[model samples]
Target: MPKGEKVKAILFDANGMDREIAPLADVAHIPDKQIYWLIVSGQGAGKLPHPADGIDRAALRRGGVVVSDDRFCFSVPVAPNEGGHSEDAMILVVGRNWLVTCSDAPLSLTERYLEHDTGETLKGSLTAPALAVSLLLAHFDEFHTHLSAIEEKLDALDEQVFRSRQRHDPLNTLAVLRRRAARLRGLVAQHRSTIAALDRPDFGPAVCEEDRHHLTHLAGAYHRLVDTIDRTRDAVLSSYDLYATRVAQNTNRLLQRLTVITVGIGLIGALAGIFGMNFELALFKGEAPAFLMVVAGMAAIATVTLFMATRRS
Candidate 1:
């Protein structure tokens, strides 16, 4: 392989053979059975690749029956009021010289695996695609670790959701958490692609049946974790709705009291106006006993308002 090109398996002997390529080609030919694995990780998994190839990338994303992109592979976590990237996923798997790398992060995830200056093993033996699957799986493993961590945090959140309210603005917190859960679902869903790779045309010798099974098992584990997150999210949403209802009820009750008070005051002012007019007949009005009458009317109105306020409570 050329120096600048990325290769999970390389065969650079005077014999001119890389294990997997040799089986399929004359130059860079390699033994039929040597296994190799490689892995790399970073952020922006959307750009990451297995064997750094498009087809393999598709395979690694095999099981889409459940999860989605935002949840499983890429995540951005931050408060609504804060600014930051939320997407973070790490997982890659490799065995027997196969490569499985997961990381869309802009940096080279395979750098560490390639750190060893010289090893015949580093020369490469597995098919490009198979190596890609294996390495991609390794990346998924890292992703699983990250998800596990998230799960722990969510578990704690679940407890708190019940122990104390989500704060003065529960809806916003619920929205943020709901967004996080959605991202998780997308990330976990990609394992479906990983599972599908088991039957792809390029199953390199490095990717053993056992390894494939392990990948499937990992996918299942992620499914369970996602389910839990979803359930928790539902609870949070319900709690948010409940809180909103209570607030609305309290507001309505307040408005009702204020409405009755205003009407009572209005009626008192009208009655005082009528009594003071006296029809110009001086019906105890000439001395402006009107002031006393007004005071009495206001007091009566106040009493009525007070009675209503008290009775409701």
Candidate 2:
């Protein structure tokens, strides 16, 4: 295991020549020039059952903090203080020697850096800490990508609701999308603080002008992403409301037609029921069949009258 270096100033990245490197299990040491953002696991992490031989055969829960120097590697998953960390992974500064990073959560930003062409960029760096900061800055582009995607989806949904001649339930789609947005929103908000802490004058404290600029840019990106999420949420709600109104209007029109038909049918039935009575009458005595026929004619006449009334209504 490596020993950690004393915490000092923040390292900056002026040029975008950030590189990616493979993570190690634990840090051997940290250099004085780098930042040590640590990702340790919680004590009670992992869901695996314990073995009789006392083997901790479970994944460790993640607990994140900034470390000045440590022996742990960035990829080294540690035992967390509490639950299994499937949400976020961790990163650490290996005692003035290397920058280690690990995470319980799936981070696309990490993937982005790893995909860069320069497999040797991280390895070729003059200072390991500075290299780590560069990789971290490069990773921010991924967050921005996700944020933009969410916004685009919301905008598309808004167009469908407003312009589509066909109507559908906007609530279902909107609700789900809103929830996802909220989740990302929370994640970004939390990340902003962490990154800000890295850039703070007193905290990790940037070393040069370049690192300071990179940190500032990262903060700005966070603000922009957050604003986009908020606007998307508003658009989702607006689309839902508009869809609701259209649905209500369609329902009311259908009911109005049904009501008219019902009234018409009721009038004709009433006329027939009244005439159907078997009460004795001088005119109906001998010509009972003829009297019934006349009653039928009157019912027909009533039906026509009811039809016209309903039509005009």
Candidate 3:
């Protein structure tokens, strides 16, 4: 395979045993009785032969789906980046006996599904629609994993917001998380109509009874996934509110301290200003005694002011 192109083919025989085949094997040449899955990574989608007729290449590139009598084609978002941006989508084209998946990069979920049976047991031969649903469900699992990781981060952020004495605002961090949650929610929602369409009786693929059940189950799973994302978003918003409250409390405490200091200084300055006046009064005749009296009086005033300022309201 070329540097930007990689392919993996898995052929499932009549006995339900899956084995690897040549990466470049032609789908048209494969036997109709056997079901095969082709995964193309990087720029492999462009290099490989098109999987089915009536597939809109433009729509596939733009993260859209096309369903027809002979094929079902759609694009789903891949795992998101740390910054919450979904930079690419994986395209899936399903035919009667074959299924082809293409993405900008190799997916670990796909590899794991290929390497080990992740509870999706193959009782009989795997049908193309069943394989497609399985892969779709696997992608939904990725969404849950990603959200769980986000939830952990939110937990850590909660600790930082409430317990840590660090004087940094968590708004930026919270904003990033909010954006990530929104992006995830948007990506999951994009498939809502498409997934619902799969359950419709008029859907193109000749879905088997078992596959239809799986498809219905997949729809339900998608709904749950959306609900999870919504809750995650709510958590982020709640964190934002908590952070704002913390900031307001800190600001109030700082202002109170500053007000106390200002009041104390003003009282002492007023006393000093009066003593420095040019008017020579009888009290100034006793130089040492008068200076001592002024000092004591200022001290007394400062003590009173300090006492009043320190008292909690």
Candidate 4:
């Protein structure tokens, strides 16, 4: 619609045939029953025509939704990476016969959704609300794929922390995973609320019974997604606990060895101190034989102390 903006539009006619069209072409020529889907990428969202009055551009950028009598508009976080980092918000505005999607970056999931065979089959059954639901479902699928990757990482971390002998500190790695999971959970929660709003009786353009059923199912799926994220976070926390416990145990073992060495050194120092006393006894007055006996006694005491220290229960 504007310079530096990338837009793609697909028009679905009453006969169910779909074709690409100029993104900013005059849609007034199309019949009211036909549907057009517009996908706009980059800094163009602010320049695109407003789908309805009272839609806040700031809210759309920050991730929010507004519903009206004939249309609804919402912005949702899109995670294009397997790391579950949401780079931008995807804004969608849907009316009776048209849907407009805008994002700051290209959405790979959207591309895949369009290229898949499912997209062809769904063309015949498509309505504005149904298409919106399908797009949202694709986003959820991306989230699931990201979550699956996270779960695998958690498993690997668990193995490294508990099974391996190498000293590994998973605190940093665990912290990162926890943060990602938390962010993912927040985005999914936002989507869950958006779906709930769509499922409400007063939601506009008035969702049909079939679309309403899909929304219900999507809501249930979002609930499960939230639960899965929570469980993954708990696992991270538990791994942290295990890691802390292992570190403490290793520290105690080190301290125990140091204590033994200190005790042995202390015993040898005491023997030397006793021998250095200025008493004129036969032990102190004797020459090399007495010195040899002192050395022998000190060595015996040090050996016994070390032996006792190292003995296991």
- Candidate that scores best on lDDT: 3
- Candidates in order: C-alpha RMSD to true structure: 10.4, 9.8, 4.1, 4.3
The TM-score ranking, best first, is 3, 4, 2, 1
lDDT of model number 4? 0.73
Clashing pairs in 3: none
List, residue by residue over 73-170, the lDDT tens digit for candidate 2.
Answer: 22222221112122444453433334434333434454454455333233332444445556655554544555566567667767775675546565
Please provide, for model 3 over 171-213, each residue's C-alpha lDDT reduced to its tens digit, 9 standing for 90 to 100: 8778888888998888887887778778777666566677778
For candidate 4, lDDT tens digit of each residue in 162-204? 7656355577788888888888887777676576777676666
**Cα error of candidate 2 at position 130, Å:** 6.7
TM-score of each: 0.49, 0.52, 0.77, 0.76
Candidate achieving higher lDDT, 2 or 4: 4
Question: Candidate 3 versus the native: TM-score?
Answer: 0.77
What Cα-based lDDT does every candidate model obtain?
0.47, 0.49, 0.76, 0.73
Best by TM-score: 3
Question: Model 3: which ten-residue window has the lowest total lDDT?
Answer: 117-126
Look at candidate 1 and tell me the lDDT of residue 305.
Answer: 86
Better of 1 and 3 by TM-score: 3
Query: Over 4 Å off in model 1, which ranges?
Result: 1-38, 41-93, 96-173, 196-219, 280-290, 303-307, 310-313
